[model samples]
Target chain A: MKGTGCISLASCKEGQTGKVIAVLGDKHVRERLEVLGIRKGTVLMKKVQQMGQGPIIAAVGNLEIAVGFDLARNVIIRVEV
Target chain B: MRVLLTGNPNVGKSAIFSKLTGIDVTTSNYPGTTVEFFSGTMNWKGKTIEIVDVPGIYQLNPEAAAEKVAAQMIATGDVLLNVVDATNLERNLNLTLQLMKIGKPIVMALNMWDETKHKGIQIDVDKLSAILGIKVIPTSGRSGEGISCLADAVLNAKQAPETNWMDKDRWKTIGFIVDKVQNLSGRKHTTIEYIQDLFVNPVLGPVLSCGVLYAAFTGIMRLGKLIEKTVLSAFEKYYSHVILTISKFLGGSGFLHEILIGETGAGGVDFEAAMGVLTTGVYVSFGIVLPYVFLFYLVFGFLEDLGFLPRVAVIFDRLLKKAGLHGFSIIPMFLACGCNVPGILAVRNLETRRERFITAVLTGITIPCMAQTALVMRMVGENDGIFVLLVICTLLTVWCILGLFLKSTVKGITPSLLMEVPPYRLPGINAQLKKIRMRMTCFFKDAMPYVLGGIAFINVLRITGIIKLMGKLAEPLITGVFGLPQDAVLALIIGIIRKDTAVAMLAPLNLNSTQTFVAVIILILYFPCTATFTVLLRELGAVDTIKAVLLMLVTTISAGGLLNLALSTVYTPRGLLITEILIIILVIEILEPVKRAATEKKQ
Candidate 1:
């Protein structure tokens, strides 16, 4: 629950993919996101930073989403890496 | 045939157009979003295909610029080429799915195919097409990969049956379909994440954020000097030679020659009689503004490509929110470093009216663009040490005070910040050079036309004695109200006309140190340039725009009065310039540790 010791996004040494449980943004924003289909169970995967502090990029399947140090903090996950 | 192309920001939509049509469109990582649109035409498959590059939006229901324009395009477009970021498929597919539901003949072009291989991403193209029920073409516009195939797909789709994907509510529904078809790897927590968690943890994030702010601001000025040195000399050489040849042919000292191109005194190039406007007009825009502006965008593009701006948002988000704004508002502030127009237009992304109001005011007033900054630096750098420090400190102080004051006065109820922090990529030299070339071309095109017209207008006015009449009319306010001379009044008029032109105007005034400082202050606040004016008018409306103008006038006058009083009365030789810099940095630094300790204590 706290830290993925060595798991990777798909099957690497450090990342894992997961679904969005809730896009718990503020009301207007949350509503807007819901309309965009960026809602509950929308799959995402954090590509653990290979360097620096940790995962610099995240993934949702093949698509790469670069995660700044700040955003990766808000994303919560149930690991299967 | 109408073909609408849309993609996420930083994708090659505009690049594709230029390759297709031979039109050079200015592209940028939208200071606000990662997306925007460009439209051009290409002759393909025996028909003139009018391709509209719809601003790349994440969805049709967009609150941001690209998304809004994108949705509007969808409602009207006949053929949709939804350009998705191949490197970021699932997030991109979200957009692709939305486009499909727009009911147009939708095809997805996965731009940046080379990045996928470099990043080691694998895409199941056949599976994706089957799931989405639309054509998906993988492309590498950079390497000329799959472009012909893409053209063929477009040609084929235009000829094929009409698909009514128009149920937009389906964007909300398609995530489930994406889930069934897309086998994503699962998420897992790791020690590395835990390590990252330390930096991103709310308590520490703000501290790290502050450090980044200090670094970026410091870095901009410090690196700005190095970059200016590298490029300025070449610009000087090239322009001097070109103008020298032109002047020689026109006979530099001739009555016709002197007005079109001024004698090279200090900085003024005398063009003959009074039409001298035409010569200097070309010089100021193409010679001065062109090179400097192009350089700024090149640096800006590099910074953007490195993904530093969003992190900047994260850093500033706390202070900005105290003003009842969000981190995303930083996008406009950052862009304001370029121009206020796009900066103001960027405010539309803010969720509420109040946020937009505050953003507009801050952008117009506090954020000085490359033009302003260049002139300010030129003056300050040339001046005596102490006054330069005061000017710099005064600017920063005013920026902070305005943010605080507006936050207090403006009524806003929204305070949320959700932004993606793209990984810091080293801006490729090839890409950087291309971006710079494109930007310079755009800037030269945009500014050259305006300058030539303005100079020509002024020339016509000068011959008719209208500039004198205008200057005479404005003299009372210039001398009495703003404490500047009658001649400097003309500079203010030209300042509002074009910043570079105004800078050129100042070279002939022969003002002493204090007068130079006063002139700069006047130039900085007179009025938004025409480009900014149009954007502000478009974004904020006539009444609000008027109010903003009034605010600028009052603030500039009051500020000028105070500065004049201070300089004339109590000015000392050795002021607190260095002390100010140190104290500001120290204050900025100290806040971080104190906040961290407090957060830790609470935890």
Candidate 2:
């Protein structure tokens, strides 16, 4: 888990579970992600990634959030095997 | 004393607010439903208290307009009733922790408590209260469980002891507290979860959404038509005769009789065609508009509570993106299909002024209310379904073209969709009925006076011969450009008050199919009714409203002219198809340069 490279949450396949490694972007974006429980160490599961780089839907702590494609790309996570 | 109801999105803060205040602010399963604050009064210990239901936000620092409103509202309240979703205590407590730092007296309502147990989640409420240094009352906003205790907690709420935690470290503090007081036993994934998964499954999701929407649309329309024929016609038949008998007893030849019962033709009162306040006004509102509005709201309320809106938003995100709006903007447009006042008001949920303006303008111009649609169906649809289809297609074309035009011209970036897709739950019928009842009450109280008064005002103008003079003045444009009769000007003027009534007025004008189609399109495009106009003025402010109105005027006249020309020459299904294709091509050509420039600017 430590040696494997981290991928952006946007790249995670549907049904993949991951631990958020870091939320990239400015204070505002990070704060938004944090408030929704998507900070470092938070475990999230990818639910749906709409085609054509649409919003990325994921579940974090029983609540599903639809993050825009641009924002989802900044959320780095380590997918569990 | 002002008590602010604050919580993370979709935590039933609105439900709790309604329970405490007896005011019905709309409550929905999805997030961002309450985009503006609603205030109502409640009696606490024999003292009247003012309570405000603030828009839900994930944090104190604002990233959007609704969140900014919530943050501003937080500073003005004497006490904060912090609602937390009991099923998601760990995540919700982050906001609760932030509220504690505001130093306001806070009482926590553990809402959705019933769901927590169902999900195999357990919370030590006493321990949680001790840790946060506040009273924590477990309450179910749906079933009203623990509401009295919540009210007691609110009345006796005390400010927390000063904490050493910094704002930046609040999450850590929340984590620490949640570890001590919350426990989640592993539970099996249920059927609802599977259904939720299917709803967002890119391919099946969109298909299911279309199916659901089609079903809801057909159900609402069919039931509405049924009620209109059965209930509404029956009510109008008896009510008009009763009013007619009374008017006749009172010697029905004077101005008062004209205002009340209207000109009694040979057959009956002629409620629809008559321009009288009592006849057309009552008939339009109660007989025509009320049935459709009721049926639409019932179906819409059920859809809203069932939590399908966000999924619809998800499916329509890319499509709405072309309109320079996020998917959530569709909510307001959907509401507009029922009526435009609440639709215009719902634009507050959008993130930017540009988006709100675009959505409002598009909704006002293109989406006909159920009443207007019903009227068009009865009149034009009876002759040919193709004409009805043409009306819809024309409006859809206008929606797309105008939306793209506004997007390219309006100066703001359309925010991307960042929303919670709540789990689909079966709607509670009792709550749904209550919501419909509340909305109906609001319609009667807020919209009815304007409908009736506007009719009376128009009637007065007609009696004084001013309407005729105005009609003469509007003759060249109304008859010459739109190809409708001069009397249609009166309908156009009355349209500003009520669009359905305006269309109904077309009945007496002896209009052919083309004239009726053109007139209906113009009525839909010209302007929203006076009630909607007032609400839009308040929502978008004066300058934007003026811009929107000007846009509507330009679009309405041009659309009427174009339709008349098309129908008069080369009038065929292929001709309409060609016109639609030309519009799409024109929009694309216009959009390409804008898209290129935007990308260049980004680079």
Candidate 3:
């Protein structure tokens, strides 16, 4: 699978693996995400995508974290297509 | 010496702390369960050691309230006991590195060690400890493995020497350490992981949650009713005979006799209608209420430990977001169904005061506690099962409408939901039973005084002619607006004390079916029971609690008045039900778009 340039994590299809490129949102949110180990270069597998603009579940290493719609849209990830 | 137990959320810090100190604090599979810290002391090796289970946090700088609390606690601790999840070593180490910078005497426990092996994770504990310059113990907090060694390590813990790693590249240092000490073999998806996936799948997730919750609700109700019928009836039969014998001993009908055994009619001491301190009060508290409470806490404890609540939260996030709440609000709402006190207490878990205020208010207004639900089921269901359904539908509609209203009017932002989803694990039966016992003890302690005192006070008011005076004073509003008789004013008055007892009070009024339906709905929406009232005050403070109570009163009168009008005018129950459903749907349709626009603008 070749790496697609970069896309909003919100658009990542379920079961797709990606490496985080940038987190674009409020500084506090960025810091909070950083604390959860979802900062730049972290590889995440999109596990579950809720219907509509709902929260999405992604795995960082072995830890699974739920990211809300707005925040997930702000997370830029390079997907392996 | 104070030893603070610190770790990332859901890493079993509370489990370890409970094991060490023998204090049965609430431990669950989800993050943020321990919103507040608990301290307990134990005698370790002839020395007293105090262990504090600090609210879990991921980093030391601290942005949230619970994180700030953990940060403050770490500063004052004599020793730091850092618990880490063995399987999620990389992420758990993020907090460990930050804690080591505090320069306190620190020891590390590899919690959930038993799961690591099955998950194909191998950790060289000695190497990790050597590299980090801290005493590391491989311990399973849930299984009580290597706990004594952990305690011994905490006793002899030493400060981890500071390293020269760049602050900007802390993750790099963590990566280096993890690569050195941790090994992973290829593994397939486990059954638990597969179930976790199914719980978050869009289509199946909602179905499963609804199925699980509905099953739990009906299961508890069935078991509770069976116990109430069989065990309580058996006890009531024997106890009534004993009480009737004692009444005859007191000559069967004096002032003291009336106070003790209540009004003894030709049928002897009637437990439900007697209204004496011993007869009705005991039956209302134990026979009517205790079964539901016991069953509720048991099922709730199991769900909480199984890590299913967060999945429910995630599934409901989109709909709840429309109401200006994060999905996590589902947790406290679930708690409130069991009882409102712990439910209100759990509101502190929300990140913003606005979310907390809104959740607390909606919960107080709409969610009837288990005891009240049981009584409502018996009373209204016996009259017309349709009315019971109506009552539930009415409260749910009110809940959604009130939530939307609060979303538009509340002054702060509701932060988006971003939380860790802990994996599922079977709850230990022993720990589950212990938690249920602790909750039952708390319930009885908080409720007994109010239950007995409220009944005693009601008796005094009746005997002293005060109730008659009060009833006459409130007659116009009771009869005119609510369409209830003046006798129902007593139930409304006692409703302020306990809703279950208030519903029981309705039995003696000989209310017709319509009046019963109206009275039950009003009792649910009016004011929270006194026990819940105090908790609301403490949790939300005076100003918010007052606002909540005022909202409750307004909603109660309006809803009650509307129900009376609808029931009296409609020739058919089907028309009434359809009208109620249409009104609910219309309200949601009208309010939802406004909330969405407002949230989008804010974003």
Candidate 4:
């Protein structure tokens, strides 16, 4: 499973499930994401990504969190095969 | 003893607080609705207990303003009333564990418990209580179930010793606890779930939003007109007769009569032109403005409770990005359409000062309140209606242009949108009415003074000849640059006090359609009214407030000057509109490169 390709959460296709490999950003961005359950090792399913550069939605344990484009770009995830 | 109600955002903490305390605080379906703490007292077992509804936060350690407010509030509480959304038990437990670490006596309310049944979520309340060494009661804020039992538990709740688990990984502990007490039975996708999916679908989302907005607009218009035509007209008929009798007794011509009854004619009081404290004052605030404001809050509260707003925010995030804002900024802009004070207050929810600044400035400079929009429609739109459209479109363009300009120059981080898109639920009619009633009370208390004061101020200006003198003084700018008659200056001056009054003031000027359009645009762009200005100062500090006001001045002058030239030069209104559109395109085209270069330099 770890051998599957890793990609930025922003780059993931809709409906794809992945584990967040790393949350790369400043302390503020990382903390904001973490509180919403987007921390390292948490699995999230890509619900939708609006208009390429728009915010991305991820489903983590029945909760849908919308991550902004810039912040979403910093969320690196490992695609689960 | 003080009990602080705290929870994750959108977890119905506020709803439960309202239930616990019987205080009608604003409760909505979105996060960040309550940015400040509200305290109320409840009597339990003959003891008065103070309950503080702290702003929602996902963690005890805070970053955003609202979260910081919550964190600050937690220290003062004697008991922690942690409200947990039962369906999302695992995530909500993250915050509960953090709260439990404070060593304060804590009671848990498994809120939204009613929904857990339908969603196939089962929680063994007794087991969870035993595991955490706390009382956990199942309650539904919507149904008011188990509230008294929760209150009883809260009163008798004992402090737990500082947990040894605090040294361990918190999420790991939460996972362990949830695993023991929680079970989920798989259920088929429901219609609400399907509608929720449709709301966020990229293509369908925008289309649905348009449909929702159009429906809301027409509903507000139809309802507002119904109230005005039926209730207001009946009110005016009986009201005018009594005031007319008083006018006749006072001889209807003196200064006293002018102050009270205004200029009464054979047809009685023309409330619009009465210029009296009693006549136009009451008419404008209660008759013309109240119905629309009532409807706006009604519709807004419905949409808010339906949990549709966050999805709308998601849809508009991309466009708002150009302005250095995200989709969350839409809430403030939408609220501003009702009034700017609440709009400005909502700015505290924005994470960064930069987003707040842009949202505040754009709202003050461009967005017209519902009252002003209604009056403008009646005052100007009654003639052509196209001019109202022109004014609205021009303000929108300014919002876009000014946003782009401010986004590029302002120094700060534009935090990305990370928010929960709460599931849609039927808006509780009782909660909606309570929210609207509270907001209407605020309108009466806050706005009525300004409306009446503005009318009295205008009458003083009329009596003292100051208005005429000022009109003469501003002739160069008013007549030369804006192409409005000299008398139109008074409207611009009173516009600072109350925008609706300013538009109503234009009614007496009887300007042509072109002049009406130009003047209305300037009125909107010049500055925010007194109430909004005070809030703007408080929300955005003095320095940024001054910057916003200065931007308003520049935007007003340039927009007014350019619009005047275009309207005067173009042969027809259509041509003028085309010129406006062309100018917007040209500005965006020119700024695109500048923005690109700025980004490149930053990289």
Candidate 5:
């Protein structure tokens, strides 16, 4: 997990599953993401991504969350082949 | 005794509240529908029990306004009804454990129990109750199962022992309980899951959303018109004829006669055209407005409960960003299309003050409620449909321009969208009907008096000749700038009270097509009625309300003046469309650089 390439969630294509390696943001945003079950080591899959800079829909443990593109780009995830 | 209903977002808290109290508030298939708490009273065991539906939240510490309200409400409640989504027990128990820290008497309602079975999620309710030291009742708020047991359990509720546990300990406790009491078996994918997947499909999402919205709009309009044409007109005709015959028999030219049934028109008594308190007021409210409002709410309630609104938000997310608002902001706009009061109130769901102010102002100015829109169609649609198109296009342009201006100037950040999209479910018919009934009842109880009183007040002004005097007083600007006759001033005055009535009054003024178009545009832009105005003042505060009013005046006058100029020379629908395209391109081009600069500064 440490040596594998880490990519931002925004770079992940639809239907790609990944493990959240780190959530890079301010304390408030990280806490918000934590409460919604997106913490380090949590597995999630990209369900849908709007074209261009639109929001991305991701699934974390049976919950669908729509994340802003800016925030999505900050969530560092390691794609699980 | 006050019993508070609390849960994580979209866990059927509102549904349980509705079931317990027999009072229906809006329950949509999305989080954040209950932005503010709702209260209802019920007589349980011959005691008056007050039930408060607190907005759903994930944790005790709050971020949004709704969560803050819920957190505050927890302290004031005598007992807590911790409703948990049975299908997602592992995730939902996180909130249940948090609520237990408050040390209140908690009666756990395992809601959506039926759905849990469908998804092969089995819960050992008795074991959960014993482990948590509380009574756990398996309830289906949709099907009214175990409701009586829940009611009985509330009376004997006991507080769970408080534990000095940190956040980490709380999660450990939830994990322990979930592992002990819950079991899940693999199940095949259902049709609802398939449809949900299709709705969010990148290419198909936009197309399906447009198709759904178009179908809903046309359904409401067509059904509303059909009801209005057949049943409403027949009832109005018969009632007016009967009233007129009695007035004629009583010698129809006296003061009492005038008060009862104002001056007659070509059709006997012409209730709407004549300004009478008894005849016209009753006719306008019951005959004209009720049909449209009823039909619109019926369709809206169905779609809302069926979990279609969030998908709408998702599809429109990118577009709404251009308006300096979130995709969920469309909920208020859609509600505003029916009426502005609830629409303004719905602004509470937005996270930022800047969004609330911008949305409130744009909605107040440009979005005409159904009553006004109906009248606009009746008056203008008969002459030419293109005029209707022109008026709509003008409003859209003004909306975009104002949104961009506010985005550039407004000081706060527009929070990115992070909304929960609830699973799609077939709405219960009874729930849909109850919602429509509750909303319609609110309309009649709250709004009907204003409609009646407004009409009577206008009649008094007419009887005293003050309306005419004021019309003459404003003649210079009325005739010179907007190209309407002097008497059109009275319609403007009445428009402030009720736009539909004001539009009805315009038929007597005999303005030409372009003048009528300008007049309607001005009417929509000038100000909302007294009902919406009061709500705006309460929501946006005095300073912002004043700013909104000033903005309304400037927007109306400028839009009216410009439209008058355009239509007076070289006006074609094709030309209007081309201009609209150019304006959009120009606005986007101008905003791109500013947006980049703002993001650069933020970084």
Candidate 6:
């Protein structure tokens, strides 16, 4: 498990496909993320967005979620290809 | 039964559809393409069920994009899941009642049930069901809460006799049923209560607002540079070297090479031409815009979700009303910062034609879009800090001044500030992202084709002798008036197609810092974007479109040309600094009187 500093989702490069190590959120948010399948060990590919690493387009299965720098900072991901 | 899922924008309609069909239709590309009802098959109780995700909308009367699609969906649904934003019960119910008036086998899915709980909102589900004469399934699509119960409710509604939400004029009915069954205990904004006074405490609000904006710009720039270096460097190593060779091998000052590569002959390296779109267009789209756009969306969404936008709405309300519009018009203007199409289209919800016209034109002209903002922020912000601040300050000043101009300078009755300030909430993560994606996707999709095509077409225009002719024809004003080199005509021509490409065109020119500033100003005030052009044509028709163009043309030439001339003589380091300070003081002083007059008028 590793924590990366805040980077836009679009800029998450290859070989750094991260395991979503944690999701820090409030109540509705906790539910929202869980519903969207953004859970612990959820394998996520950083889908390069219109903005690289500024807003990482994180994908789990068919769900694509854009995370800005702030939210991404809190999301510890196990960086792996 | 063919089931239709529908609701107001950002409601759980798509969320529910995704849950039911397990299908994700990228809801991003709305501005570029019209997505009718999306269909996917679901297996329910060992039987194949066809599910349709209708576009979200407020009314069957069909105002917005989703509304039209929903109206179309309702026209042909066997069963309808009328998803309601349960927290905003009254607002959601208004639309639900409208759908019920249509006499469909409707199932009211109360989405966002989790939020309703926190708000101390109580909707007796059974009572609401009985009152509406429809099965009401209170659902939280977020946590997978009550989803099965919702599915069961849909199944039950299919077997049972159908019912309506209301039989007569629904507000009258809703006013009654809601009066009895719905209890909205106004929760002390536990929520944002502590921050409310802090965020908008007159003096405190301004300080906080300025501090936040300053931080946002600084944060985006600092982070944006790192992302750009990382993303663009990787792209260059992969693509630039390859495309450069291929572009060289083609070896022609001819149409094909020019169109394929740029006229500057810096055709990125091999495969890079094919791939440099990622390097340049895609990189610009994501990298440059990403940091700031994300920041913009995050900050704006937080402000929005925290209910600050409404307070801003309250502040801007009287100003908006003066221009024959309401404070709601500010949304489109805000959205205009992303891009102008939706910003323009969003004007449709305005109460009157005059409001839409003024808002559309003003948004088109005044709002520096993502592409332009990206370019300005990237080039100017990175290279010079104080100048960048100056530009941003100028932008804000212009927005306020133009807003006041639209409100007062134009002779029209002040519009109303009739709006619903949604309660402040810690904006949901997924919801905020969903909103951001919805916006940025619309921007990217609309711009991508035009950007690629504009680059290609600019290349084609150069070799085809079209640019030479344009340069010559526009020489008098382009050079003589605008005080720019004839090459600037090319930038202006390209600006019509896409603004960033026009600025990108400036890279080849050996212009000094002052010239570039003038160029950017010209780009901002010069003309409406292609998307904005179409919307203007649609909303104002031909005559106003022409007037709009003329207004832009006169302003661009005058503003840009005058600034250029003035700066050339007066822009010695000491003089320019002094002038800026004086202008700042003058502006603040001008604003004080205006505020006083406005307050006096109010009294």
User: What would the per-residue lDDT of candidate 6 be over residues B398-490, giving only the tens digit for each residue?
Assistant: 445555555565444433333333444565577667767766676667777877676676666766889899899988887776677888887
For each candidate, the alpha-carbon lDDT, in order, equals 0.61, 0.84, 0.87, 0.87, 0.82, 0.62
What shift in Å separates residue B140 of candidate 1 from its native position after superposition? Answer: 2.7
TM-score for all models, in order of appearance: 0.75, 0.93, 0.96, 0.96, 0.94, 0.71
What is the DockQ score of candidate 6, to 2 decimals? 0.01
DockQ of each: 0.14, 0.71, 0.81, 0.79, 0.64, 0.01
Candidate 6, residue B45: the lDDT equals 76
lDDT of 1 by residue, B1-603 (tens): 788777665566775665666666644443234234566778877878888766656655666554676677777777888877676665666666655545678777878777665555566777777766777788865556787787778877732233445554454445555555444444554554454344443456556656655565556555665655554455455655666677789876755555566556545334211235545665455445655566567667776666666655655655564455766788787777775655777787776777887788767765666756766666656767666667667555555555556666766566445444544445557667776776666566666666666666565565677878888898777776666777776667766666656756776677776777767866776577777778788887898789778877876777667666666667542444454465455434454467679999999
How does chain B score by TM in each prediction?
A: 0.77, 0.93, 0.95, 0.96, 0.93, 0.78
How well does candidate 1 score on lDDT at residue A73?
49
From the highest TM-score down, the ranking of the candidates is: 4, 3, 5, 2, 1, 6
TM-score of chain B of 4: 0.96
For A25-77, candidate 4 gives per-residue lDDT tens digits of 88877878877888888899999888747788889987888888888889999
Regions of model 4 farther than 4 Å from truth: B166-168, B582-603
User: By DockQ thresholds, what CAPRI class is model 1?
Assistant: incorrect
* Residue lDDT tens for model 2, B321-439: 77888778888888898999888888887777888899999988898888888887778776677787788778878888888788889998775677888888888777887899899
Model 6: residue B128 alpha-carbon error in angstroms:
2.9
Task: Estimate, for each residue in B1-603, the C-alpha lDDT of model 5 and write its tens digit.
Answer: 899999988888888998889888888777777887899986778777889999988878887767888999999999999998888786678788888888889999999999987788889999999888899999998988999899888887888876666877665677688889988899898988899878777789889888987787677667767876775568566887777786787697666666666777656767767777677777778776888888878878877787888877877777777878777788788889888988998887787888899889989998998877877877777778877777777888888888877777877878777777777888988888888888899889866777677777777777788988998888877877788888888779877777777787788778888888889989999999888999999989999999999999989888888777777788665587579767876665566667789999999
lDDT per residue for candidate 4 within B143-248, as digits (tens), equals: 8999999999999989965678754488788889988999989988899989988988888888999799889977787778788777667756798888888888
**Candidate 3: lDDT of B440?**
91
Interface RMSD for each of the candidates: 7.6, 1.2, 0.9, 1.0, 1.6, 15.5
Q: Candidate 2 vs candidate 4: which has greater DockQ? A: 4
Docking class of 2: medium
Off by over 4 Å in 6: A1-81, B1-14, B17-80, B88-102, B155-191, B248-255, B262-308, B318-325, B378-386, B393-414, B427-444, B535-544, B569-603
